[model samples]
Every structure is written in C-alpha cells, then in structure tokens.
Target: MAVTDKSVLYQHGTLSLLVPGLFEGTMTIGELLQHGNSGIGTVQDFNGEMVILDGHAYQVVETGEVHELTAEQSVPFATVHFDDPKVTTHETKLTKADVEQKLLTDYPYKNVFYAVKIRGIFSHMLTRVVQKQEKPYPNLTESTKTQPKFKQENVEGTLIGYYAPELFQGVAVAGYHVHFLSNDHSIGGHVLDYTLAEGDVSIQPFASLQQHFPLEDPAFLKEDFNYAGMSTSINKAEK
Candidate 1:
C-alpha cells in the first residue's frame, strides 16, 4: 500500500497471523521505514521487541541488549507513520493509565487510529522482550511465557507505538501497544507499565489504516486463521 498522506498509519502483517505462529517476515526494515519514521514491531521469528525512533530501527533482545537494525533486517509485523504530531502536550508525573486516559479524552474518535510518542524521564519503567523462536514455533502466547522482562528507575527514553480501537483487535493491538528505547540505547522493550517523570506527549490521529498482508509467505497464504480464540490469544500474549 502506498501511503502519501502522512496521517495514514501503515501496517505490515497482522496479529492474527502472528498468533498462529506465522513468524516468517515478508517486509524488510528498509522497506518498512519508507512509510513511516516512528512505530513499533518485532524482528523476524520474534527475535526481539522493535522500536523505531527518529527514522532508525532498534531491536531490544531478551538479554536486554539493543541493536540498531540494518536495512536488510526482516520485520514480521509493524505499524508506523510519519512522526508529524498534530497535537503536542507537555505532561508531568503521569502513570501509563493516565496517559492513555488523557489521549482518549483529548481525541475521542473511538474508531480511528492514533500514533503516540512520549519522550522524557520515567521514574519507573517495566518492559518485556520476547525470545527468538525456533522451528515448530510455539504460538505467540506460549512463546512470550519465557520472555525476559526488565525494570528500571529514573530512565530516560522514548515510547513509540499506537492506540487502536477495540474493533480492530485482531488487525492490531486494541489499545496502547508501545515499545520503549532508552536515550543511551541501553534498555528497552515492550512496555508493560511506567510512570512518567516529565515529558512531551505527541499524538497524531489517522482516519485510515493501510494494511499490507504477506501474500508471498506460504504460511500466511494458506493458514486457516478462523480460530475461535484469536482475540483471547492476542490479549494473553500482548497485554
């Protein structure tokens, strides 16, 4: 999908495919960045949590190591858009829930997509990075069971991710699906919780979401994705 409009959110692949173990990546990091500069995703085979900021991709692995991804690195699933904030708010001493509530209250278009970026010092931060999967891969929920989690205090970083409506649960995470990357590139992962010390919250709302499927991957092409528990699995694995 070609997204000339900067307001549109560009997504590659779906959580529905990831839930059932379709880990093969059809889009390269280089290609994924053409559509947006800031977003979140995972590397091929769920190797780590992917955080894109300032037009560069970083992988936060299970060992709490952060690597700047090359253009050739493969991305199984991601959501990104041009980091042009329509509204920017300065906030201090807010919890994760507080931030979410503020965004929702400020932008109450329940069915649209919202890209969020928060950069500042965090008094408390908790995150988890999924381990890379091998062949005969376990489902997303099962794989995340052994994922390594990390916590830090007074860490400085940026939170990059999106807020999708509940109606789009399978296509994307229903609520806030954010990943963190520290200023020094030392700590980062899928954010589980945090308390913002002080920061700038930027929001860009999009009326359209362009989803590109992995039509070339045999697993993505042939898998029966009509399982009854897909939503349950996504909630279990992501939240």
Candidate 2:
C-alpha cells in the first residue's frame, strides 16, 4: 500500500513564502520540467495560474486566457511528478467534500503526499484566478479577497493538485490544494469548489519529496516571513 513507489514529487520553492506574498521566482518552467511531468503552481509576480499535465506546461492569466508556457517563463512555486497513478472510476456524482472523504476512506494513509487528478463532467465548477501583483504584493489572503471567480456548468475538465500531511503544514498546505483545466484548454483556474457528475479519480501517492529553493534570489533571501495566524490565513485563502 505504498503510494508513489515509483516516483518522486519534485517541488520548487516553498508554499509558506508564496502565501505571504513572495511572488519572485527562483526557478524557470524549463528547470521545473527537468524534475516531473505533472503538477500545479503560480507564475512570477503572482501574475497568473500554472498547470503541468502530461509533460506539458500551461499558464492561465487574469484575462481568462490559457497560454502554452515557454521554457524561459519563471515559476514562483510548483509541484511536479512523473504521474503513473493508481486510479478508480466513478459513475456516481460527488461533491468536492465527498471526493475528499472518499479518498480518505479508500486510501486511508497519512504522512505522505498524494497527487489527485479527477477527470469528468462537472455539474458546477467554481474557480478563482488571482491578478498579477505589483511590488509589495499583498499577502495571499488579502490578494485572493478581490480575485475574480468563475462559475461554469457541464464543464469537462481535470482537477490537478496535491494532498500533504500535517507535518508539512507550514511548508505546504496540509490538505487538498487543487486546480482545474478543461479538456478544451479554454477554461481553468484555481479550484475553489466543484461537483463532479461522472469521472475518474487518479491518486498517486508519493512516499518521498524533494524541495528546491532559490538561495540566490535577493527577495527570497531578505523577506522576513511572518507566520502569525498563518493557519487562519491559509484556511481563508483556500476557499
């Protein structure tokens, strides 16, 4: 029952700093690809969203457009892995919460990382996209407060994200953090909530993780990250 027996999750940067408004990136999309084929993350300056699926990289900007990313593009934070998941198909409908519960009920393993990919038609998909921030960017909670939200129906897409254990809480979000990409590649964003009509849920559990940080970046080096009430901030930001 060891998940990710064959793959390692290659992560760049730290989620804690990004949450607190460190939009500067230490790694390029090209460099990130050297590690894994699939994952999710944000672009430099918090300009837009990022999705890596099937060894390809994509960017979803504030303009509601999806662009194929170039190697030179910078990434502030991302999680990627060579995905060969253990999957299960479901014909029944399920809410976001229900999906989480089902994952726990079946897998039931703690203290590991899981790459969650759900593909199907969604009855309702509620998503949010953060705008690019200027210098002195606001923290994640404040930045997301004014984000634009989209509501779509009968949308076919894949939900991409990761589930981390409590031990990595401050370093990574402890629970599910997923993003969405439509099959047509026209509609996608950070998933706030959704209901799946029917689809397949592919779960890849990674027993090991590798973190890469940008030690040379001045911003990453100088920022005095304040974690006070970070739990509350993360909870508010996730929704």
Whole-model lDDT values for every prediction:
0.90, 0.83
The candidate scoring highest on TM-score is 1
Each prediction's total of clashing residue pairs, residues at least 3 apart in sequence or on different chains, is 0, 0
Query: Candidate 2 — worst ten consecutive residues by lDDT sum?
Result: 1-10
Error of 1 at 139 (Å): 1.3
RMSD of each: 1.1, 3.0
lDDT of 2 by residue, 1-239 (tens): 21333468878887887777988767888888878878898998887788898878888888778898888988888888887887766756899999888887889656688889998999999888888998888888877778787778999988999999988876778888899999887788899889999898888888688877878888888888877888777777765
Error of 2 at 192 (Å): 1.0
Model 1 global lDDT (CA atoms, 0 to 1): 0.90
- Show where candidate 2 strays beyond 4 Å: 1-6
Q: Highest lDDT: give the candidate number.
A: 1
Q: Please provide, for model 1 over 1-239, each residue's C-alpha lDDT reduced to its tens digit, 9 standing for 90 to 100.
A: 55557868999999888898887778999899999888899999889999998889999999999999999989889888988899988999999999999899887656799988999999999999999999888888888788788999999999989989988999999988999999998789999999999999998899789998887888888888876988998988899
Clashing pairs in 1: none
| lDDT over C-alpha atoms for residue 77 of model 1 | 94
